[model samples]
Target: MPEVARVVPLPHEVDPQPQRAEVTALLEGGLIRVRLPDGREWDAAWLQAGGSTSIELAAHDWVIVLPPAGGHPAVVMGRIGPSARPPRRHACASRRPRC
Candidate 1:
């Protein structure tokens, strides 16, 4: 496996604001995936509707991201599912906590 970071979402989780644009950017950037518990899979950019938790990032470890689009950072009400791989340097490096 080439090792990629995955961002998983939980069901019924509410996002303070639906960041469809940001998610599309990430998907177009080729850095995200949607992992379903039922074994279905999809690209991050494919996420359209709001309130979907069954998202996952495969290949490398992922860090929760809250983009500063509006004055308030986008919120994700889900967990980054457990990973069997080590955290990738590019995953958390060059990132700072939002003030």
Candidate 2:
């Protein structure tokens, strides 16, 4: 593949590449805060499908961060499988009852 030139969302040592990060917070400006593997936090832009049916990104969700390309800002590509939401519990089960 051809080498691509890009810039990170913020000034940091992390090279421009696809990386896994945990969503920490969602911003009002269509951006989100993510903590890198190095424990550094950065504000990044988000990209999602247009006509969405029901896909929401929440805190603690694992997402892919696509570093800026062609002068674009970093984007939260999308949430990965195994969401952060707790699994559904049964009322007759051991722990907490289902609401």
Candidate 3:
């Protein structure tokens, strides 16, 4: 009982839903990546905790991390168990400015 980091809450959001090509090839062959919670590297595409900076995910909602100008609030990583392939369609592809 040692690998703990589950603030759970994000079963859906950041729409344009349509992900099942083997779950977008397991998130483009990298298999999801959004770990935050003070560990950094969220690279947001959509992960709000409450009104404003909205993306959409209503049904017992509770998100966080609105950073920028003294940023904070993290944790967005996914994949918590077995998945043969079903949902897919996630985002966040705008971090290519380090030439």
Q: Which candidate ranks first by lDDT, i.e. highest?
A: 2
Model 2 Cα lDDT, one tens digit per residue, 1-99: 944544445557547678899999998877788987889777787664553326677899888887655455668777789646788777778777569
Estimate candidate 1's RMSD in Å: 16.0
- What overall lDDT goes with each candidate model? 0.40, 0.74, 0.32
Collision count of model 3: 3
The regions of model 1 sitting more than 4 angstroms off are 1-28, 46-78, 81-99
Which prediction has the highest TM-score against the true structure? Answer: 2
What's the residue-level lDDT of 18 in candidate 1? 29
Per-model C-alpha RMSD = 16.0, 11.3, 20.3
* C-alpha lDDT of residue 19 in model 3: 21
Error of 2 at 57 (Å): 0.9
TM-score of 2: 0.56
lDDT of 1 at 50: 50
Worst 10 residues of 3 by lDDT: 17-26
* Candidate 2 residue-wise lDDT at 85: 73
Kindly report which residue stretches of model 3 are placed more than 4 angstroms away from their true locations once superposed: 1-70, 85-99
| Runs off by more than 4 Å, candidate 2 | 1-15, 50-53, 68-72, 82-99
Model 3 residue 73 lDDT? 24
Question: What tens-digit string does per-residue lDDT give for candidate 3 at 1-99?
Answer: 744443434334433332211111113322223433444443332333344333333322333333322232232322223434765655545556576
